[model samples]
Target: MMSQYKSVFKDETKLDINYVPYKLPHRDRELRLLTEFFSFILHAPGKMAQRIVIAGDVGSGKTVLSQRFGMNATREAEKRGINLHYVHVNCREYRGSLFLILYHAVSVFHPSFPKRGYSAEELLQILLQVLDEQDAYVILTLDEFESLIEREGTEAVYKLTRLQETRVNKPQRLSLICVMRNLKILEKLDASTRSTLQSNVIHLEKYSKRQLVDILSDRVSLAFKPLTVPEDTVSLIADIASSEGGNARFGIELLWRAGKYADADDLNVVTPECVRKAASSIYAVMRKSEAAYLSLHEKLFLLGIARFFKESERAYASLAEAEQAYAVVCEEFNVKPRSHTQLWKYLRTLSAVGFVKTEVSENIGSRGRSTIIYLPRISAHELEKELTALLEKDV
Candidate 1:
């Protein structure tokens, strides 16, 4: 039985979601900006604290980008005789507790550090004192920082941003890279914290299909055996992920799942069928459950959006276009179409539930402003099929 087992993965760990590649394709500019922004720590350590915000949507490479930069920056600092440490704290895991966040950072160096009995401020001071005695510095990355603000409110932001104020006349020992899905969360912060953070912000846009292809290709080379994954399979995965806001994570997940399917089936190579199976397994159930809650008009409205994408083969469609398609769908269903106001309400509701994404476009020629809609996680073609089957059953 052991001899019959066939595997295609050269190093499975390479496909791990948390694994940060040494080279990040299509993120050179962002990485360069990070290097420049934090260069102060290497050139003049302990002179001043640094803080920057990294904003991007899900799967926009925020966490990996920061980790990559931190890894490289620490190595460079070490070469220059600076003892710089990199600490990445996921705010979601700590539930945005200020004390817990600080404790985690300290525990990285002092594993025996007590977990309780210290206020946030006191923990912060202790952390700083430890760093001072060791003559070390840290580049602290707060991932999912919005969680911190949501749970602890603006006070958490204020405390982290104003760390330098606590140790006046001493060398700054901590710099911060706050990562969030988007900077809109900053609106809840106090003016001082917002202004300080807003001054240096790095925005990472979603990866394009070609970019995702390159990324997946790189991972495949390291994760799978030679010639096991063909170009067609990689392209299919990229195509599927591109429909979902060009999410690289989704693309990578598909690739990994495809490989797993190949291995489980004792196949020598990963095929397009494996990718399809992977995609369906990942989101089909969730999508169905979510769509099941929609009312009839809501389903019809979503079906219209899906049909618009199917017909236009475009990434985005105008609100007017979607409404027009929706009207057609309503006619086909033998139901009266909702007014424009009601359709707008449907759009909002669908967007809130993650069925569709919308943005206001200003450059619509004669149309001053128009709402642009696109599917975020599911492919339009697949969504169309799903909604159509459900609508027919309802009828």
Candidate 2:
């Protein structure tokens, strides 16, 4: 029975989300900027600690870009006779503990290093000493760095940024590349700390449809058998992902899922229909669970937004229009409608939970700005159906 199953994947590991490709499409400019920013390390290995922040939306390739740059930078540094090491730690994994983060970085060099009985400052000293003895420099990339700021506050950043101050006139052995979803978290830091990072920040923009297509095509060639994934299937996955802020990760995930579906059916080729099946399965599960947690009014408000999208057939609806739709929904359900202020709060809650996406846009001819709202991942028609079922069941 197992032998009868046909396989379409050449190497499914290539489609793993965590797998970083050797070549990143549409990120050469950002990679170049990263190399130039950290070039000081090559010229003078321990001149001063270099730090830069990479900020972007989710699935914008910030983590992969930093990892790729670190790999290449270390190779280049070695060719020039610099003893450099790269250590990547996700703040979320460390739970934003300064001590654990420092310990992990140190353990990369000294795996036997004691995890207990040492303060964070002590660990820093030991790490520096180890680097000095080995004549080594480190490029530490802290991914999801905002988690640290949230848990430990700005002091975590302050400590890492001021590591050089701990040892005066010593070769600065550690360079930092802080990866975050966005730079808004920087607002919490003091001006001095912010300024240190503000000067050397790289922002990655979302991928376009064409860019996503190129990216998916590259992965297909590596992960799937030749000609198993058609251009139309790739284009369809790209179109779906591009709808949700051009997230390349989502496109890759869809491609992987579609391949699994094709293999399950013993089909040789992945079709556009497979992509659609994968998307529906993903969103249906997500929407049901997420909708269950919403309050009655929140569900009604979301249903209103969905109705607005379906009726107008537009990508976005203004806050005013959405509110009107909400009122109509309330009346249909024989429920009292909330005030504008209350609905505004609902909008915030919806966006925070990923149920809806809101953007502020300037009115072309008016002085006032308007909030435009839309569904990000799921379709309006599907949302309306789900919310209607939930709301009716509640009734």
Task: Give per-model TM-scores.
Answer: 0.74, 0.73
Pairs of residues clashing in candidate 2:
none
Stretches of candidate 2 off by over 4 Å are: 1-3, 285-395
Residue 200 lDDT in model 1?
A: 96
**lDDT of candidate model 1 versus the reference:** 0.87
Give the per-residue lDDT of model 2 (tens digit) for 1-395: 56776778999999897898999999999999999888889997798788999999888999889989989988998899889998998999999887888899888888888778978878878888999999999999999998888888877788788889868888999889999988888998988889988888999999987899999999999999998998867876776788778889988998999899789878899865566557767775454778988999999999998888777645567899998999999999999998899999999999999777677778998898889776655656677889999999886
Write down the RMSD of all candidates, one decimal each.
8.3, 9.1
Give residue 355's lDDT in candidate 2 (0 to 100).
75
Best by TM-score: 1
Prediction 2 global C-alpha lDDT: 0.86
Report the lDDT tens digits of candidate 1 across residue range 1-395. Answer: 56766688999899898999999999999999999999889899999888999999888899999999999999999899999999999999999888888899999889998777879988888989999999999999999999899998988789888988867899999999999998899999999999999999999998887898999999999999999998877876876788778888888988999899888878898876566557767875445878878999999999998888767645577898999999999999999998999999999999999777677768745857778776655656677888898999886
